[model samples]
Target: MNNEISDDNSDMIISDSDSNSEESIEDLNWIQTFLEKPGNQIFVEIHMQYLTDRFNLVGLNKYCSEKMSTMLKLMTDDIDFLRGEYSSMSSIEKRMLDKECAKLYGLIHARYILTYQGQYDMMTLYSENIFGKCPRSACTGTPLLPMGLYDVPEQDSFKLYCPCCEDVYRPAHITQGLELFSGFNGSVLSEYKRYQQAFDYPVEKHLTLRDSELPLGKNLDSEGDDLNIINQVLKFNPNIDGAYFGTTFPHFFLMQYPNVVSGEEKPKQRFIPAIYNFDLHYNSQILRYQELKRQQLEEKLSKEYDPKLIKTKSKKIFTSKTKMYT
Candidate 1:
């Protein structure tokens, strides 16, 4: 299992005997430093295929024009600019360019995932469980899918959900899990929001996970509290076999239960959000994508696609035609 990655995010490899082929760590310093970081690593050689059309990145012109140019050149294997530009740009400018290069890849990624090929490619990744497996014991390694609790990036972070368990897990112990798999925080966390500082390795200081920042299906509940203490499961209860009916009416299990809010019996420890994925998926993103496809198809087909556009006229001479035949 030397090459087999663990769900603990691969840090469990306590020791390694491999030696570097090139001993001078300073050699190829920039390339080494860049490769070591997760920023542009997601774009890797695989993303170079997308650099052919800058037009696909229609709205990102304002980030860093020069860096974007550098990105294109780099993807095309033209490092001559780095060697040729001897004294013109400041180091700060160069740094910004590097930053924007990653940014540009991210912008393209958003468009890329929407393409037919991109979805299929991601589907393969999803099938492989590159996002990792469901953490619950009962799930017994259900492959996870990348999901955002909220579509509007910053409000909530990405989660790994198992359709079988109908539950969500914190993506791959958070940091190493994401970078190694998510595509610099993987495919889902791109363009919409900046990568979290948790992925900042070897340089940026560590960050502690907060109660509010805890993964979905997890909560900070006191032991004595009745609602939270009963059985700390937040999603479909892990104890039961068929707890997940569907995302619809999330509060149904708790809402219908007797004396949940008052009286003798203690309540089930489930909480419902004011807004949830069921609303966002069916009511927004999925519906929006479908509507967008419909619009595009209709536009391409023009008026011919619309049967409503055709007018039906009453035939006043129908009786006269019958009389002529008689």
Candidate 2:
């Protein structure tokens, strides 16, 4: 009876161990494969915690936008079965979810890094020189702080900044480039300063183009405005290589319309595909062939004389010819 009880206990312990291992694997499946690294464990937990709590997010639709529903479902899986399902999903779908997850995490992490808790965790990494050391021999192996060139996300990657040197240095690891960072560019008061900030105080260099000088067209009262812009363009670009400066600016037909503001250049929409620089050689060749065919047709039509009297000799001497034949 004592042996049977010991055997039963051992069997239960083995079963529990197997179950725990399965659960760990399932949990790992929920996160991105790259994120499963032991070094990234803390960050992955923080990201999931933030994602689990919707209150931390503002404009939840903005980051993932169209993928919000799917992303949310994929992100919020806490159960073993739900987490296990992640591996079974299609590769395209998995990649798409992973992308949105990364974007969402990045957005939150940007804000999270500013928090004391987040900074404390990051500071630990900082001390270890995980972000990389300043390359300059002046400060040998000085751990660099991750700072963004622009506070705006996606505009640029986080660069390692050397406090000792006050210059940007390449990160020791490429993964450090993905770390959350805020730049001094957002405001002089922002947590960090630009790499150039310490060396030279930034002097604002805004050019105030004389708006009074660049009128789109001549005034109704006088043709006074016509020469102003031409003079200005010549004043600026005095030297030219190929073409002599034409008095007239290249004006689009849209500029003459009352609805279109000629002063402000219309912005291209971000969503719209701009084909301005796209190679349209094949399309142009097709159009050229069609144009030639049209020109030929027009030339033929133009050459034909209109309504020249063609007197039909229907009352011909056909009678004489018929009689001779008979």
| Model 2 quality (TM-score) | 0.39
Q: List the residue pairs that clash in candidate 2.
A: none
If scored against the real structure, what TM-score would every candidate get?
Answer: 0.38, 0.39
Judged by whole-model lDDT over C-alpha atoms, candidate 1 comes out at 0.39
Cα-based lDDT for every prediction: 0.39, 0.40
Q: Once superposed on the true structure, which residue ranges of model 2 sit more than 4 Å away at CA?
A: 1-25, 29-34, 37-44, 47-49, 80-89, 172-326
62-109 per-residue lDDT for model 2 (tens digits): 645436655566555545434566556766655555556555655565
Off by over 4 Å in 1: 1-49, 62-67, 86-91, 147-157, 165-168, 172-326
How many residue pairs clash in model 2?
Answer: 0
Worst-scoring 10-residue span by lDDT in model 1: 236-245
